[model samples]
Target: MEILQVIILGLCLGFVYALMVSGLTLIFGVMRIVNLAHPILIISGAFVSYWLFILFGLDPILSVPAAALTVALLGVLLYKLIFEKNAAQQTYSEMTVLLTFGTAMVIDGLLAFLFHNTQRTASPAYATDAIFIGDIFIPLAQLYSGMVSLGIIVVLALFLKYSEFGIAIRATSQNRTSAELVGVNVKFVCLISFAIGCALAGSAGSLVSFVFSFFPSRHWEWIAILMSLVVLGGMGSLTGAVIGALVLSVVSSLVGAFYSPAWSTMVFFLALFLILIIRPRGLFGIRTD
Candidate 1:
């Protein structure tokens, strides 16, 4: 029963984890540039939700779209100011990494200056509330967040598969030069894709507004684990990211249940190492040239 409970909780949490990393994955998939600022964008979303609830008495669910769109707008500005200069560049190896990392630090520093590195949590009464069936229990906040995560993933999948704009995005992701040759506006695609990616990070943060305690610098704590999920899943692969997140989340949960909680943090690193050793491309990752 305890193990079953652990698995259930792990799955729920995994959705949120997957959601957290999905934006980063999508950005990488489309641009091949690792956005180090992705974590800070998530932190910004959390802060937005926090303030919305604290100052305006809005619900976190309502804050989702608000925060998402706000960050998406910010993402556009970022693309214009920072990524645009290098837009025509084929590879984003050293300079892009440095730029994004620097951007992350600047965002973090600004937040720290304002929020003072203090842990701020959005308190909605239902955050602690739970649903139970027989002997099983589920936290309402996490469950709602998980549902939102899954819903977003479904919507994104549909968009990519059906929408004309999404088709263009997909074509660009597959081959930017080919997409441009076919009359697709690659620049527009890149901008929209970046916004969508940032918006995803925002919505994911809003979902967890009440579930996690966060400080401005918390992005530092999250980025490593999130990156592990990306690497373990095979960078830029949505399915891979989700599967990898589920596997790592489950492993971490089980480790905490069966072993010392201290060892739970090692689960991700261990899982990544094992997966990399076994299949260098990850569970479902396929690199395209």
Candidate 2:
């Protein structure tokens, strides 16, 4: 029963983690450049929910869209002002790494200045509510957040399958030059992809606020965990991200339950190492040969 509870909890948390990395994976797939500032945007989302909850009494769940929108606008501004300028540079790939790293530093400092690094969690009234089923326990917050994450992933998948913009984004991701030759606005696709990624980050942040305590600098830890998941799942594969999140989250949860929460964090690195050793392309990574 205890093992069952742990697995269930792990699965729920895995869903949230999957949603967390969706944007990161999307941006990588489309732009072929990692946005190191991605985690900071996620933290910004948590802060957005935190502020809304404190000032307007809005629930964290209700604040998800607002958080997503705010960060998405920020994402657009970032792409237009910073990334777009370097989009055509021959060194764009390497440049983006430095650029995003610098951007992340700036955002981290700004958050610290505005929020003062205080540890906080957005706790709605239902935060403490739970469901019990024959000795199994499930927290309402985790259950709802997980359900919401899964639903959003499904919607995103469908949008990519059927929507015009989604088709364009997919085309650009597959082959930028070919997409442009076929009349796809590659630049716009990049911008939209970045925005979508940031929006997902914000949405994940709102969920994170309820599931865990967070602070301005907490993004450092999250970034490490998520990057590992991204790499483990395959650098640019959304399906891989979800699978990696589930695998690692369950491993971490089981370790925490049987061993120590302290060791659970190490599971990410261990799994990453093993996966790299066995499948360098990741579980779902495309073969390059």
Candidate 3:
């Protein structure tokens, strides 16, 4: 029963993990540029939800769209100022990594300065409520967050499959030169892809704000853990990221429940190492090169 509870909890958390990694992987697939600053954008989203609640008394869930849209606009600005101006010959160049990593640091520092380094959670009364099943209990916040995560994933999937912009994004990711030659604005697609990716991150953050306690610096921990999921699933595969999240979240939860809390975090990186050794490209990862 305890193990079952743990698995249930893990899957619940996995829903949000899947949502978070989806954007990261999508951005990598389309641009061939890993957004190392992605985690901070999620944190920025969380702060947006946090402040909206603290200042205006809005529910965190209700704040998600506003946070997502805000980050989407910021994503536009970020691409224009950073990536657009410095289009390198090599997409995955060392300079791209440094630029994004530095940008992550800047966002982190600025957020810390403005919001302080203290831990916070958007804990409304409903967040504490739980539904009981026999001997197991599920928190309302996790359940709601999971539902919202699923909704967002479905919306994205539909967009990618049916929408014009979505088709363009897929074409560009599959082959940039061919896409450009065939009337797709490759640069514009890149910009839109980055924006959508960041918007997803921010929406995930809104869910995360209610489900977990976090500080501005938590991105360090999040990025490391998420990297494992991203790698385990493959860099650009949406399905892979979701599966990796479920597997890793379950593993981490089981390790924490059966072994110790401290070791739970190690499981993430360890999974990354083991997966890389077994399959250098990841379970479903295709080489972009």
Pairs of colliding residues, candidate 2: none
Ranking 2 against 3 by lDDT, winner: 2
What is candidate 1's lDDT per residue for 208-242, written digit by digit as tens?
77888888788976888888899898888888899
**In candidate 2, where is summed lDDT lowest over 10 consecutive residues?**
280-289
User: How many angstroms is residue 205 displaced in model 3 relative to the true structure, after the best TM-score fit?
Assistant: 1.1
Per-candidate alpha-carbon RMSD to the true structure: 1.2, 1.2, 1.2
Task: List, residue by residue over 5-107, the lDDT tens digit for candidate 3.
Answer: 8898888899999999889988988887778888899999999998898899899899999999988898889889888877656644466678888999999
Task: Give stretches of model 2 more than 4 Å off.
Answer: none
RMSD of 1: 1.2
List runs of model 1 lying over 4 Å from the truth.
none
- For each candidate, give its TM-score against the true structure: 0.97, 0.97, 0.97
**Of 1 and 2, which scores higher on lDDT?**
2
Which regions of candidate 3 fall more than 4 Å away from where they truly are? none
* Model 1 residue 166 lDDT score: 85
